[model samples]
Target chain A: MKREIPLFLTAVIGAIVLAGFFVPHPYVSVPADYLQRCAVIVVAFGYALGGANLVQVNLEGILRRHPDWPYKLVLLAGMGVTLVFGLFVDRAKFQDPGTVSLWIYDHVYVPMNSTMFALLALFIASAAFRAFRVRSAEAALLAVSALVVMIGRVPLGDAVMAGVFDHPGLPEWMRHLRLEPLQQWIMDWPQNAAKRAILIGAAMGVMATGLRVILGIERSYLGGSD
Target chain B: MTISTDFGVWIAALLTLCVFSFLYKDNPLYKFAEHLFVGVSAGYYIALNYWTVVDQYLVIPLRAAFDGSQAGGPFQAQMQDYRGWLIVPAVLGVLLFTRLFTRLSWMSRWSLAVVMGVFAGLKTTGFAQGDLVAQVQASLVPLWIPGDLWGSLNAILFTVGLVTSLLFFFYSREHKGVLGGVSRVGVWFLMISFGAGYGYTVMSRISLLIGRFQFLLVDWLHVR
Candidate 1:
């Protein structure tokens, strides 16, 4: 009965959501928006559960005298310290001001994130060197396009290629002709097709899941009903 | 000003150093900073949602429902008629929490069903127009090109690339002689597209990391 009910509900709800899109009535749309808002809250709660799980697993490792126990302790300490500072620290007059959370976010988080990203410039250069071999026709096309785009982005390319200029140079022509046209073609064709395909797949998945939930075919959430 | 600016600069330096520590095999201080980040982030979201959505929209208005004077609550004064519908969602939101209780868990579906059905209905027509119809329309092009040999060949290859790639994804048919060859070519296009997409994704993530570094160096530390 428990399983059957969920499956039935999922099917019905799935159909309703699909139907609601075309129905064009406030009766359906309003309810759907409200449900979506509630889902966000529920998802937020799920994140809380995830945070709790992180603490629990890490703390357990520390208590068990695991080899990497010090790292686990560091993790727990970090979590605890941040939680304390955010929840308890005064926002208005912290000397450093802008809420303790914001202070951490702006000063600590953003810089770390940017530094990590800057490291990618090194990785990209290395990867490009490895990928630059002319093995296939497609490879040659990619190499040429990449080189043009890279050179076009810099001032040095224009200085070196100045002899080939009809007022503005080869870089300008490449940008307008090769890069712009290619970008336009991609936006016009392939991206659209892929997006539609993905949307259809996602919509189908949502319908199937909704049906399972609404029709009572899926009782995974019901915690072993007797 | 000096004190506040100095503190900001110091904290920014600490964050920068902690982040860069990852380059030198992960260590204790780095782990500590990472966890602290997650915990603080969670708390902020909780506070933001409770303040902005729940407190502002739900709880205050529900209270106003009982207050006989129909006019003077914070939200009721602002929104008026829309305030009543808050009950429906509030009830549904509460019902979601009932998943914690085993016997009454089935009620959560009422909320889920309503949400999914409505979004799908709302999005279908627009998604079809924007993502499907427009895309297929753009794919169609005139075959004749007047100017040059290279231009004509480029146009032909581009058309072939677009159509064959689309056909390669078709699950309904078995590809046999010519169709098989076209589909094989389609696979190459898909690989390049995937590779390019992967590279772009990597670039985006790295850029985000660089933004963080720049923030620390320029804004926080005031380092040129």
Candidate 2:
């Protein structure tokens, strides 16, 4: 009864949402909108539950006296402080200057996030060095396009070109051989085409997966225990 | 270098240093930052979700269903409207909290079902319209433009590239003969796309990296 009811509910919700999309009548849309709103709230409940799960797992680690339990304790303390400020202290949620929650978000979260992504720059350059070695025809093509894109995107490419070749003396066709235009052409033509094809493929995939999910065939979200 | 004296700036700088230490090796400071990041983000997510969606969508409306006004009493919505008929979902949402209890965790599946169904329905039609139809429509350009040689060549190349790329992903049959050749061309286009995309992404990251360094130098320390 437990699993069956869920499957039935899924099918009904799926049907109604799709119907709302196709039908466009108020009778369909009103209920559909309401259902979606309810879904959002329910999903929020799910999110809160996810947080509880995180806390639970960490608390258990602490209780078991795991080797790195102190880190878990720090994590809990951080969450507790942040939650108190966010949930109760700043319940109004306006970006008031006095809100400690906002301050933490700006000072702690945003900079940490920025620094994390900034760290990726080093890794990406290392990857490019290994990838751009150009061992095969396809790889060579990729390397050339990437090199062109990287160079064209910055002022360095144009500066180098201006230093090496005088634009005034260059012929009309030769002037068009600038890396900027060349990269733009590659992006507008081949890249656009590739993106379109990839999106089409992805859309087909989404359609299939969505349908499967709707029909409850994909039950992986329902854990194995029950 | 003149150092930042503001406590918040000092905290941010120290955390940034802790995070950046990963370039050398993972240590206690890095682990501490990583755990704190996870915990804080998760906590924020929970609080934000609860306060924003569940309260706005569930609690207020449920209140309106009884008292004919939202939680704060400023906004007045008629309780009898179809929108107020969220009782079933409210019940389901409460059931989701049952996940915390070992014996009643199975009840959470019902809420999960509703969430999945609606999202799946939304994404299916959304992708159909935005991705498939739009791209296909855009690809229907004039294959042969008169008088303009490059335009005509570009149009032809775009059409061929798109067609071959689609064919390359078609794994329904064996890749041999004409299909194989077309697929091979598709591989070239895909490779170019990937390379260009990576190159573009790396440059953007570098710009961000530069921004962080600028912050560290100019904001945290009065050095350039």
Candidate 3:
């Protein structure tokens, strides 16, 4: 009875949600809209679940006195501090630019994210040196394009080449024909195609998962016993 | 000689040096930067969620709705109507937290199911119109261009690439003869596309590193 009822509701609701796209009637549209609102609330709940899970695991680790326990302690501290400030801390006193929260985000958070991303430049340079060999026709084409882009971007490429070749020469033509056309081709075709595929897959996945949840085929998420 | 200019230059130089260190090998300095990243990101997301909920949902709307508190407030009446709806979501959000208590965890599914249904409906419409239909339509372009031979060539090549790629993605069909040949070509195209994407990502990373270097050298230090 427990499973059947949920599954029946799932088939009914899921079908209606799917049909709502085609149907313009208030019956479908109105319920669908309410369902949408309900989804947002549910997703918000999901986030809470995720947050609580993080806290629970870390807290448990700390309590057990496990290795790297101090880091877990720090994680708990950060989570607790943030939550307390969010829920209980007086909002009025920190009204301006110099609030503790704002200051932490700007200086601590932003810089830290920036620095990690910055570290990837090293990996790129290494990858370029090792992987950019012209082994085939396609590889040769890619290598030439990469060289053109790099030369066009940097001043050293122009200065060094201008001395050997024609002045104001290779970089300008490279920029006009190769770099521009390649970039345009990438943006117009491949990117759009990939994005479309992802959208389709994601939409289908959402429908399947929604049906699973509605019909009670996905009772595991609800803690299973019921 | 000056403090601000000197500081900028020093910081920029340090960042540049740190980035350059990657050329040699990974070290503690890299790990330090990485850990700081993890810590700060976790902190930032929590702060961001608070800001979004408090400002958009609770604070601004509540003030506008209930408080007849602002003069020249045309939105006051509408806000009041909207305020009532907030309770539904608020209650659901609270119920979501019920997962923390094992006893009441079952109630969380009600909220979850509603959300899944709505999101599914939204996705169905958006994907059909924007992705499935639109992508197919885009591929069905006029092959011949009036003036430019190159334009016509590009159009033909694009159509070929698009169709082959789609066929490659279809896993249900057995790859025995013609389909195999088409899919093999599609595989090559997909690889090249991914290589291009990787190249772009590398450039983005480099640009970010350069920015940090610039900040460390120009903003934090006195050196020119």
lDDT of each: 0.56, 0.83, 0.58
Clash total of candidate 3: 19
Q: Where in model 1 is the C-alpha error above 4 Å?
A: A55-97, A116-226, B1-5, B68-126, B137-159, B202-224
Question: Which candidate comes out best when scored by DockQ?
Answer: 2
> In model 1, what is the error at residue B169, expressed in angstroms?
0.6
State TM-scores per candidate. 0.68, 0.92, 0.73
Tens-digit lDDT track of model 2 for B87-107 = 777888889988889888898
Q: At residue B180, give the lDDT of candidate 1.
A: 83
Could you give the DockQ of candidate 2? 0.65
Q: Write the per-residue lDDT of candidate 1 for residues B1-224, one digit (tens) a residue.
A: 12226776677667667756766768876665665555555555544455556655667766776676576553442212445656666666666655555577677655554444334443454456554566566656665678776556555665676677767766678887788888877765654454444444555665566576666567665567
Give lDDT tens digits, candidate 3, residues A1-226. 5334444544566567777778878767656555554455456445556767777887788899987667666666656665565445626443246566665555545555676676776767677798677787657545554454455345565555446444465665444344444554654555444444444556556556655655556656444756
Question: Sorted by DockQ, highest first, which candidate order results?
Answer: 2, 3, 1
DockQ (Cα-based) for each candidate: 0.27, 0.65, 0.29
Give model 3's docking category: acceptable
Worst 10 residues of 3 chain B by lDDT: B74-83
Give the lDDT of residue A106 in candidate 1.
Answer: 67
